[model samples]
Target: MKKRRVLSLVSAAVMLTGIVAGCKSKEDDKIIIGGLAPLTGNVAQYGQAVDNAVKMAIEEINEKGGILGKKIDYRSVDEKGDPTEAVNAYYSLVEEGIVALIGDVTSKPSKSVAQKAAEDNMPMITPSGSEESITKVGKNVFRTCFIDPYQGKLMADYAFKKLNAKSAAILFDTGDPYSTGIADAFDAAAKELGMTVTNKEGYASGSTDFKTQLTKIQGSKPDVLLLPVYYNDVALIAVQAKQIGITAKLLGGDGWAGVQNQLDEKNMDVLANSYFCNQYDPTSSDPDMQNFLKKYKERYKTDPIMFAVLGYDTAYILTAAIERAGSTDPDKIIEELKKTDYDGLTGKTVFNENRNPVRLAYITTFEGKKEKVLESYSVD
Candidate 1:
């Protein structure tokens, strides 16, 4: 009887192992997508927006029977805006059997993950990493937003033709690739358009005081001051410029998208009459965009930011590629993604040879913390 009991226990253990193996096999069969975000950091707002949007898109797709007739298993990691942490997150995702990846929302972390992903030939797409070199890291890397150079040139042309500005000054963070890349392109395009670039100045990152730079730019008396920096820096610069009594029209890239939220009631006055090129116009009248806004508001109880729109679009784009490929194989998905011609909430996006999106820019401005879409510009 003791021997019989031992044999029965051994049989149960074998059965349990079989069940676990079967479950693992089933999990492996599902299409898995991993996301990396800076979920807790100074840029947490951007990361949170993207994370919410991506999950929303995945939920919507799953409700419709998911991609390739199986439900998608979405996993995400918080890298906390650190480059080294981002790479570690990618490895964790890869180990979890993810067939595709979406994220590392900011430029530097995105680049770090892309470098590692490229070595593995993993298909990865960044929703809002606009640095020119991010996609240049590997063919496997792609983005849904226009690059820094594109935004810079677009604003330069707009300033010259629409704003009728004859002179512009640039103040950027020399330590930041996003800021410096746009500054260089704007400088070149401004010169090409016969707009004088006056008093180009650079500062170290995390500097709270820009009065020194503003004073020099004030002396130049530029018709426009191009600040191709992030929203926080833009806010500080705008406040300082206003205090210094500089009247140059403020212009920025997509980095300035959420500056309105970063300012207080009194400081909001500083952004008056400022314009920035962005991914999408929050006030767009397009039926698709309106529908997305409605759904997003219903889900998040707030208006979607530019990063949210990009994240939603990236999810749709990636899923569409998986559907077109008829498989979750990374190589197959990458091939289909290359042929993407998605008319998303952001805009019609197609990957250029460099794997960057060929899309137009929305010239957006603020009116007392409300974002208004002024116009859209294509490469002409």
Candidate 2:
């Protein structure tokens, strides 16, 4: 097998060598991978979790003698949860001739990179981006987590069939494709499932007070309140909901993955019996997941969120693809990635035509400030 070492002075210079030679680099002597995430800003939790987990996966893979006898070189950038910054990061990585990419943890930034990968035919995979349109950008794009459409419908079905919730209310951010997509999908699914959508309200993420919207939903007296946004918004709403005496069961998507890490016990008390879709069940009995959970807690001094598990799975999937293809060629990796069926901490992942994984999603609920696995369900 070909083997090369990255020079500290100009690690990515070798990738540009092939371009100067006029042919695409089929497989280099060394393997390189790139990642993008918003490591700072309000959404930093998701990005930091993904970054740490991806790094952990890379370390484990390297220790095992890496794919085809060459250790993998990885470089990740902080997108700061901004689309413009994410695109800039993508170009820098692309110039380095990375074999594959895992990144842009959020939907918007993920979309930015996926678009470039489509135009350039570069292989890219997102760890936690749930916007359904992400994969639509390019055939080379993929994701480790379920999409918003499926997740929305999955939760809607859960509310109707499992919880027997007759009426639902939704509070989402219209400006965000992630939030609106889920709200739209849930509304549609609720109607199809014969469940009543008592009230649906939209708000901007910057708005601190939700009294205007919450007041309307409170009057509806819905059995459940769907919060398909990130943890920051979810926490604020949780506090507001309780202050307003709203006792409805709260439901959310993977965006609610790391609630406890952000909010205190009293701030999260409103969601005592609430639940949200997650990428991995930290409390699952699955041996692989158990091992991951244990190691993650030990390494991070805390729990692993869904983004972290998805990021780890993204690294595993890329390495598995490289192993199956036996080369760093993007085309070969894409071909092998489509056949992926590896059991990960998240679950068994199989990529469909759109490059989205078809897998089960776990639901997490809190018990006395402790997040616990409620159950897992399939979209099928």
Candidate 3:
């Protein structure tokens, strides 16, 4: 077995010298991992949560002697939710000699980073990027979250089978692949399930007013309204929907995870009869789940969101692969990652051929600013 030691400044400089050479020095033992996320700007909540949880996981792993007897050196860059910035951040991390990557949290930037990472065959995993094309870029790429199509179809099936809804309406962002992907899947699934789609409206991304769409949807009087967008858009649309007297029950995908923070007591009524698909059950009674939640709350002083839990899972999954391989070779780590079957804070995660995890979808609703998990379902 290999031994562990803290690398001195001189030893670290030598490792960097090896990186500057043609090949990395295996004799210098320390695993370098890179993280990319929008730590500021639009989707800061998602990125901050992921970054915090990943750091927490790394701290715990280091405390336990780390993988392969080498402590992880984590380097993170903020992409600020921009695709170009995310690609730039990816290159920066690669220059710093990262063996593996976790991030580019949202869908668009994740796809951008994944495409670039594929060129170098870097083992990359996005914790909360639901875009299906993210892992399709390369075999070395994987994700801890389910794809957008899966989430859309899951919500559609839930609406039809569980809620027994006869009709539905959709509001999506035209510029966002994430929103449109889910909307398209939901439309097809709802139609296939014999539910009527009264109105399917698309608006430009970053639009503040949704009354035009909501008023149009009101004319159809659908039983449910689907908003397959991020938390900011969800908050805006919910307020606007209420203003237009749209009384349809609200439904959404995992992107709705942090929407509660965007609402106050006055507007909370808009989400009274609403539910959304999530990555995990926040109210789980399971011991592992409770322990994670407790630690996360103590560390961040806030309840862990789906992205946070996914980030925590990704760190463990990546390090576990490194430990199992017992080598820093990217190929060995990638192969070990392909066989992952770890039950994490979120749920059982087994990677499929596409490198998408097979996990349960949780249906959650807000109850007086607290999230209540109502049901859990799995889709093939």
Tens digits of per-residue lDDT for model 1 on 1-380? Answer: 99958955764565456445534654744788989999997789889889999999999999999999988888888778888778867876776678889997999999999999999999999998988999998888999988989888999999999999999999999999989999999999999999999989999999999999999999999999999998989989999999999999999999898899889998998988799998887787889889888998998898788899999999999999999999877789899999999999988999889999988888988889898888888664
TM-score, cand. 2 vs. native: 0.88
TM-score of 1: 0.90
The local distance difference test score of each candidate is: 0.89, 0.85, 0.89
**Model 3 agreement with the true structure over 1-380: per-residue lDDT tens digits:** 12313424443454456446514433356788999999998889889999999999998999999889988988788878988778866876787778999998998999999999889999999998888888999999999998989988989999998888999999999999889999999999999999999999999987898898899999999999999998989999999999999988899998898798899888988888898998888788999889989999997899888889999999999999989988988899999999999988888999999999988888999997888889888765
Q: How many backbone overlaps does candidate 2 show?
A: 0
- The candidate, 1 or 3, that scores higher on lDDT is 1
TM-score of each: 0.90, 0.88, 0.89
Residue-level lDDT tens digits of model 2 in 35-107: 9999998789889999999999999999999887888888888878888778866777776668789987998
Scored by lDDT, model 3 comes in at 0.89
- Ordered by TM-score, highest first, the candidates read 1, 3, 2
**Pairs with backbone N, CA or C atoms under 3 Å apart (clashes), candidate 2:** none
